[model samples]
Target: MGFDADTGRLDVTPESPAYGTKLRWSAPKLIEAANTTVRGANMRTLNVLSPAPGKAGPATAAAAPDPRPTMPVGPVHTRAPASDGYHQALAAHQATRPERHVDPTIAQAIEAQTHALRELSRRAFPDPDPDSIENTRAKRRRDAKATHAQALRRARAERAQRGSTAAGVQAPSDRRTA
Candidate 1:
């Protein structure tokens, strides 16, 4: 019959020449015809399952069923039983040791070492010139820039190789066998 483009509803029995043609069709027949027409149109327009345009080839086979197990099929069982003998021995050993203690001689030696460390640190650190620091930073940035450029060139070469392989695969000879 007629269709409302805005709402997508069909006018099954309207007062028109097209409506007269539809009125004679049984409901089931009309539905079947509509489904067939829609499917054919979709086959032409949607390209939903096509391997490629303008390239005829065998329809792809359905994928093989997965051989791997998707889930555990049987009740799981463990051969080795859990044990705590090692943990118990460790706990008993830790409890027997003294966790806190101090020796006066060691404490005095530690104080002397701290004083020596402070003196060493005072003599070891010299103030850096800002100009030298800036120069070093600039040199590092320049080296990084060069490395980045090299990486970009390498990437381009790799991409070119991949493209060449792709082009080779799509050559006419490759299609001739198919």
Candidate 2:
């Protein structure tokens, strides 16, 4: 990822369909969205359902403004640490607006999408017990290493035994003829 200080834009290469769009992050944004749920606006649902920008019907001189879908992912901006406002107004608007929610169908769709992605991830990757050996390949590898070590030990023992015997046996020509 590259960030431009001039334009304040981020440049990121796209990932493949399956891997690129995986939602691995946990964001307070989701909670915030739930709180700021527009009364009648289903932004995401509309983005999905409507025809893409410049693909709507016939292009007209004065038709509705070119439609732009709200993308699921947006660039994030990090703020540098700054002094807090000591006199910031607390609850400047005294009127209490009760919690509002998006359309039921849109909410259901959002939840369903979340669940589906989670299911895909869970099924793709499974955690195996660390204490117990489950994979046959690992077991085979361990067995092979053990067998090789045993072979090495046997060869060394045989060499030591032969060396000891050779040393103990007196050479025929070394006998004194006194």
Who wins the TM-score comparison?
1
Candidates' C-alpha lDDT: 0.59, 0.52
TM-score of 1: 0.26
lDDT of 2 at 113: 100
Q: Which of the numbered candidates is closest to the native, going by highest lDDT? A: 1
Model 1 C-alpha lDDT per residue in residues 1-178, reported as the tens digit of each score: 3454444345443334454545455545665566587763221111112122243334422433566878878978866554699778888999998877779999999999999998888778643568877888999999999999988887876677669778884423332110
The C-alpha local distance difference test score for the whole of candidate 1 amounts to 0.59
Candidate 1: regions farther than 4 A off: 1-127, 169-178
Task: For model 1, name the residue pairs that clash.
Answer: none
Error of 1 at 83 (Å): 86
Off by over 4 Å in 2: 1-98, 131-178
